[model samples]
Target: MQGFFHGYAMNGIDAKNRVSVPSGYREVIEARSHARIIVLAPHEREPCLIGYDQAYSARLYEKLDRRFGDDFGPERDDAARRQFGATEQLGYDDNGRIVLSPMIKELGELDRLAFFIAAGDTFEIWNPNVLLEVKGASDPRLARIVRAQIEAKGGKA
Candidate 1:
């Protein structure tokens, strides 16, 4: 609970585009916000969906304010407006699932399945095929970094 997202999970998308949030991630979100709501947005530079709980979203808002300042200029206003406009506050259903909007699904190229990749402060939802391609083509340095991290943690690479 103290750390950021740190694992991966895959869940099926039903005909209605509903996918269950991974149970581990649900625990983290519930512990942080005591609610089953998450803010989701298409990644600005990736073919995936990014998600954050309420607390993290607030932190991001603060960061944005600091970066953009509290001025009334068009530049600042447009940046904030565009970012906010692209995000959606999605509430989980009784089954701990959320329905992905058509736009989100299309943006990620999500079809029958979603691959959840844990990022530091946010998680990403990806199309399984795209994730496979990305992993297959990832830089060799990334593999070295992962091996180093595992070795540092006393695990064999």
Candidate 2:
């Protein structure tokens, strides 16, 4: 709870494009903020979506501020356009699900099923098949890394 996201879950996206947040993840978000909201943005280099809790989003903003400063320079402008401009704030419904926008689904190549992969400060929403391919289904090293990360976060291995 005090560290990063540390598990994976496969969820179904309904026709309305809504998917339930993993229970553990929902608990983490609820613990951090009163608003049941998640911030999602297209991964900078990957064909997936990156998600962050409100607390982590503030941290991201702080980092961006430090890097860009208050200047109207090109770096600041580009960063703003890429990061802030692309971010989406999604509120959980009564069912603890978030509606994925068409743009988000398209960018991430999401179909009916999505695989949520937990990273340290954030998590990723990926198309199931794409995730398997990208992570290499036969690679034991990836599993080891994920186990290590979960353990480091004080989660069950």
Candidate 3:
């Protein structure tokens, strides 16, 4: 999984809403996509953001095409529009930090910290508290990870 996202990290978001992308994810982004860029989009059914390399974004587009063959209906149009419109290409700086825009921040309600969990080709950026409210209790394993990270950051577990 050298070139795949497979870990978790939490980083402090600065006053300017910039946070360093975890080093491991940076490595995977470049290795798999040939660029130090991240494609970010609001998660379809979550109050979080989905981040991945450009390559994966292309793959997702192709997947949509395959899934909607010969169907030029409003449903397909809406799906493509939402998926593509929300996606943003962000370039990390020398220190591997990207500035989250107001819209991006609003999408996840991100504040002090950025919580990340890698899921294969994509990683999720979440407001830890929201994640807990949405997923924690129902997902014991994930709850443990999120709780430990929160407590490690001086937040109540």
Best by TM-score: 3
Pairs that collide in candidate 1 are none
- Which candidate tops lDDT? 3
Task: Give stretches of model 3 more than 4 Å off.
Answer: none
CA-only RMSD, every prediction: 6.8, 6.4, 1.7
CA lDDT, every model vs. true structure: 0.77, 0.79, 0.90
Q: Tens digit of lDDT per residue, candidate 1, span 1-157?
A: 3557778766778998899998888878888878899888888888788998988877877878898776768887787776677888889987889998898789778887777878877899877566555663575654454445445544444
For model 3, residues 102-130, the per-residue Cα lDDT tens digits are 89888878999889999988999999989
| Model 2 lDDT tens row, 1-157 | 3656878876778899999988777777777766689988999988899988888877877888898677869978888788778788899977889998998889888987777888877889887556556774576666565555445544444
Q: Which residue segments of model 1 deviate by more than 4 Å?
A: 139-157
lDDT of 2 at 66: 90
- Give the winner by TM-score: 1 or 3: 3
